[model samples]
Target: MPHPILTDLETIASSTAAENGFDLCGVKVFTHLKPMTMQVQIRHIGGGDVSLEECASFSAPMGEAIETSQLLNEAYVLEISSPGIDDQLVNDRDFQTFRGFPIEVAYRNDQGSELRQAGLLHKRSTDHVHLNIKGKINRILRKDVIAVHLTRLKG
Candidate 1:
């Protein structure tokens, strides 16, 4: 279980993010830096890309706010960022918002088989998604899509 201070910090961060026009904001701590100095990542709720300018704008005030607060100590370094285009589709909200955009899903077929499918997002409900495949141009309902992700299309 996380300490109460951590939870409180999250709430503060969420509120600050909303006020700063960030759709999503999160804090990450790393015991060691492997590929980068600080492993901090922030992304949109629907997995859209965030620009470097946006990152700077979002992080500055947030960092200041956290620093001034008495709740948290200086144990973790803050890294602010935006989500990349090809991130995983985590929630139904993402699927709904990205409707009509290209997406990929891996699901189980009607015959109890596994399948990988990619196409435009037709619709997203609570537990299922309707996908419009590229060639067929018809929506396929996959109830057990184990993973869904947004596919970045090139111009």
Candidate 2:
């Protein structure tokens, strides 16, 4: 979990992002590093990808919002970026948006080894997700999904 201040910052940033046609994908505050950094990941509202110019355009207001909020105690690097093609499936919207696309899901076994599956997203329900792995259909409960990301973007 992030600090309460960071959560507040995310809420503020989300509003700013929405007004400028952007989706605030994620926010992180790295306090361990020498100079703490606040990384903000965003995507274009229309979808596909986010461009460098779009990130630049959103930076000013985002920075101003952070400053005005008085959330940070010292200087920090505000990184604005696209969530990218490999963004983790964090919510229902993500599962629905990438439906029918290729996703690689992975989980850990009892021995701590990682197992992965790659296939088309066949279905998503209230409790489980179906993936067409090879020619067979595999159903995995939502709680068991350790990691899910689009593999088609990997090249």
Candidate 3:
């Protein structure tokens, strides 16, 4: 279970992202560091890539919201960024946005053996991920998936 403070921070960050026409992709808090660190990832809500300028544009409002909420009593570094192109696909929005794009899925089979497969993303369902490999659609159980990532294949 995540800490309540982390959840509250996520709520504030998410709301700030939405207000700025972006979607909150992820939030991570690192308490072990000297001053602590909070990293927030955001992406364009319209499915476009997030640019450096956009990250800068979001930083002000995000920082203001966090400071206004008074959720963190201690000093912490707030890092705002975009999930890079090669980052793993971990959310439904990513699956939808990258539909038909080339991807690689790393998973474990029923025998508990690790395996990797590359294909075009077909769709992701509640229980499985559908991939189009060489004109055939293959379904991989969600439980077995270790990671799914966008990939670029050299021609």
Q: Rate the local accuracy (lDDT) of all candidates.
A: 0.67, 0.82, 0.91
- Error (Å) of candidate 3 at residue 30 is 2.2
lDDT of 2 by residue, 18-77 (tens): 988888889888888768888898887776688899898889999998888888879788
Which lDDT value does model 2 have at 29? 88
List the candidates' TM-scores in order.
0.60, 0.80, 0.76
Count of backbone clashes, every candidate in sequence: 1, 0, 0
Candidate 1 local lDDT, 66-97, one digit each (tens): 77786644465677876556767666666666
lDDT of 3 at 8: 91
Clashing pairs in 1: 43-83
Better of 1 and 3 by lDDT: 3
Model 1 regions more than 4 Å off: 1-9, 25-27, 34-51, 69-76, 91-93, 106-116, 137-143, 153-155
Off by over 4 Å in 3: 1-4, 106-108, 111-116, 125-127, 133-136, 151-155
Whose lDDT is greatest here?
3
What ranking emerges by TM-score with the best candidate at the front?
2, 3, 1
lDDT of 1 at 155: 52
Compose the digit string of candidate 3's lDDT tens values, residues 28-83.
99888869899999988887888989898889999999999998889999888988
